[model samples]
Target: AGWQGTAAQVVTHTLNRMQDEFATNPADCLAYIGTCITQPHYEVDERVASRLPETHLKPGGKPGKWMADLKGANLAQLLSAGIPEAHIEVSPYCTWADNDHYFSHRRNEGTTGRMLAVIGIQNKPS
Candidate 1:
């Protein structure tokens, strides 16, 4: 399958799994971290666009690869799962593709290292 189709399947499956998992193991809050490449829509190929469910072909940035609001998409998913907007947090960093701090598949052409971000609440002291 192409990247576009793979992305769509992953997002849909992940969201569905999250909904099921949260029902049995609910968290007080959720955090989403990653870089959403900010660019013009023209930069993204039709196949890429078709895979993304939250892409808006809006203008107002670089000439290509219109900004993809991953955070917004995640928020929407969370909201649909009954998670309030206020309970979710999004990071501002753009990851490796947009920044040197992280590894980007686009920048390195699938030869980049992986960056992981983990989240969990610590037990409170009585």
Candidate 2:
């Protein structure tokens, strides 16, 4: 099966860093695939959300694609965890817009193909 979602990259970077720091030589990573549901700019959805005291997002439109916000937060967390910024690479692929290339659970409505990434780690022996 193809790999799914953008989280896979982050997952791999994290694993790779851990393996290196722990002197594990090399390591491998698995797919980080799952459902992702966030606010869409649909009129009806926005209208309903406006009435709620607490919302899925802040008042002024969506916050820079909260999915991306979560990603940025994840990036920060990983950095705090000792992973360098230069070591981590995040794709700018937008699921909703890059449907032609990347598979989107939302755009394809559960019938989409996934993309996979292959990482190899040759652990150093202690």
Candidate 3:
């Protein structure tokens, strides 16, 4: 139940199926990024939480604690699909953490001034 029922569940299942169909290595990943890890230094939103195995919160962490367990599970799923860990890359700036750089809907007071940042391998120029 680590992630079979969580949002990451789709990622794992999808990646596995993609590898099986395309006969590609996980290193040839077909996915994107994860979530923002709960940092002690950051005053994250504790309202976001998950079930034990489905959560990245440490043991004994309260329900109000922030969690990115699904994100971690997604990474593992990609690796299991044959993608190398080295290929995975993520940044807080893409999440709600970095408001100034990355527009956050909530932090921006539901303003439409948020920036859309996409992460993926750039295709070679034709």
Q: What is the C-alpha lDDT of each candidate?
A: 0.51, 0.43, 0.50
Residue-wise lDDT of candidate 3 within 36-113, one digit each (tens)?
A: 322332222433343324335543345455534545555665676677777776443333565555555545666846
TM-score of each: 0.58, 0.48, 0.54
TM-score ranking, best first? 1, 3, 2
**Candidate 2 weakest lDDT stretch, 10 residues:** 26-35
Error of 1 at 120 (Å): 6.3
Per residue, candidate 2 scores C-alpha lDDT tens digits across 1-126 of 111222244544655666667654221222222222222421123444333223223444444222123334344445544556665665655556656766677667789886666555545499
Error of 1 at 111 (Å): 3.4
Which pairs of residues have clashing backbones in candidate 1? Answer: 35-94, 39-65, 39-66, 40-64, 40-65, 40-66, 41-66, 43-65, 96-102
Estimate the overall C-alpha local distance difference test score of candidate 2. 0.43
Clashing pairs in 2: 3-115, 3-116, 25-123, 25-124, 26-121, 26-122, 26-123, 27-121
Q: Positional deviation of 22 in candidate 2, in angstroms?
A: 4.0
Candidate 3 lDDT for residue 82: 70
Worst 10 residues of 3 by lDDT: 35-44
Candidates ranked by lDDT = 1, 3, 2
